[model samples]
Target: MAKTFASQGDLAEKHTSFTEVGDGVYAFTAEGDPNSGVIIGDESVMVIEAQATPRLARKVIDCVRSVTDKPISHLVLTHYHAVRVLGASAYGAPQVIMSDAARAMVVERGQEDWDSEFGRFPRLFQGHEEIPGLTWPTTTFSDSMTVYLGKRRVDIMQLGRAHTAGDAVVWLPDAEVMFTGDIVEYHSACYCGDGHFADWAGTLANIAGFEPVAIAPGRGDALLGRARVAEAIANTADFVESTYRPVAKVAARGGSLKEAWDSARAVCDPKFGAYAIYEHCLPFNIARAYDEARGIDTPRIWTAERDREMWAALQG
Candidate 1:
């Protein structure tokens, strides 16, 4: 299984960075692991994207304590991914929020995803046992909602779908800063196993319309300037298109999944090989792209058994 998931052997710890992207906005990023954002309001704080487990969540809590003692009033999850929402219990925030579509996903395949992700990458779930169970949202919105942290007005909106069906972005109108869950990544592979390839570019356009000065992306470094923000958005769009186009072409030609995989590598490796999680996400991305090209509107649920089966079949 030479083409097995690289994350299986990626157990080394990544160095974490806490960067302030706005007046009271912070991005807690670990090398290229899942990132979390903190917004300190006049009276309380709001956190975006909980880590994989309570143990991991505590690391974010530590960073919040370093700057302010304000209690965490809300924990906003960008999607229903296990690594993003399973740590919700740790926050103890009275209001846990997500998009209404995200909540339906949690009820649909949340457990399977938790099992699949835990089996695929154990390093992220450092304290798996501490996870109470599947995380649920106390509050949900259809399209948009606003939460005020004293004077700081944070707008949470489901701006189309890219990484997942229910991707949400946290925006600060005053600071022109946004916390984009996984809709955008900086120098990190965009995992598209459950993504909407066709709508991804449109979503990028929506985010670009806001002209954010800074962004705390789902992974990688915090974008601090308009130049960097623009670059990341453009690069993310490029990555999504690059992965989908080649694989889609292969499928349109009636090629097998393995053939589609080869086509994707031929185009992507030279351009994105240096990115974090590039290898780990390649097989899944290609599989989904192939499916989408074949008119699979909804992505099939990924289970632990299916993960192994696909890896074995894709093995070179």
Candidate 2:
């Protein structure tokens, strides 16, 4: 999983893939890097998350163009991660939307996240020079909002905080499908540096509340059928819980961060080793989980320097 990171000077250059999860929805993934979801409505289109740059985002747009010519009217940021929202300009949508809390995250740490993620995973940002700037949401809401593309109804709701403080999901009630960004990753190492473990588990239950026929998780292959979807949710929950619980116990016992990291590695790596980015993400996930379990409520800002320090200590 060393492939997931690079220094600030490095940049991402990887192949991409697009798969259809439903009749009108698509998931764009790159070697288990961050994933992007697209939903085509009756007369327009909605993009769930933007790539790290406009140039990279256009690849997904180009693929969609091969199937339909509907104008992309909305770009919905599932959260404020730079890899997910910085590509908004490429969509050229009339409105860029996200949860109100998501917008706040952008204001609070969008710039720092940009630097933090660029340093952590340069392979995910293929065309960094094309980035316009930190992405800002043009529209936002508190709990839930419904958007109509002609007669098609798409429900966007902030189910609860999981991956981030402002995590949200896009649901197609009629289609019985949902786009759960990072809430349910299938066979992928989840990035939990800024996540809330307890809240995240509860949010997964909220997503299960929809009983979606299929779910496009933030990473890995899209899950189809009720059983597969449930597996996705449960698998991700297990990853998150296993990443936190034992490490938290170690920390609570006054174990050093390195000791906590080692314990998590011994436990989680065996269980999730084959999963994508398991090694690259484990250090950060363990560190943050340890901190959160010790009552650090808000996630600390991750600067480039901090990223290297943490990596050298835990993974180098």
Question: Top model by TM-score, which number?
Answer: 1
RMSD of 1: 1.1
lDDT of 1 at 145: 99
lDDT of 2 by residue, 167-285 (tens): 88999877788999887899988989999988988999999988999888898887889999999899999999999988998989999898998888778878998887776678889
> Each candidate: what lDDT?
0.92, 0.84
lDDT of 1 at 101: 93
lDDT of 1 at 33: 98
Predicted candidate 1 versus true structure: per-residue lDDT over 170-210, tens digit per residue: 99998899999999999999999999999999999999999
List of clashing residue pairs for candidate 1: none
Mark the 10 consecutive residues where model 2 has the least summed lDDT: 1-10
lDDT at 271 for candidate 1? 91
Cα shift from native, residue 277, model 1 (Å): 0.7
TM-score of each: 0.98, 0.94
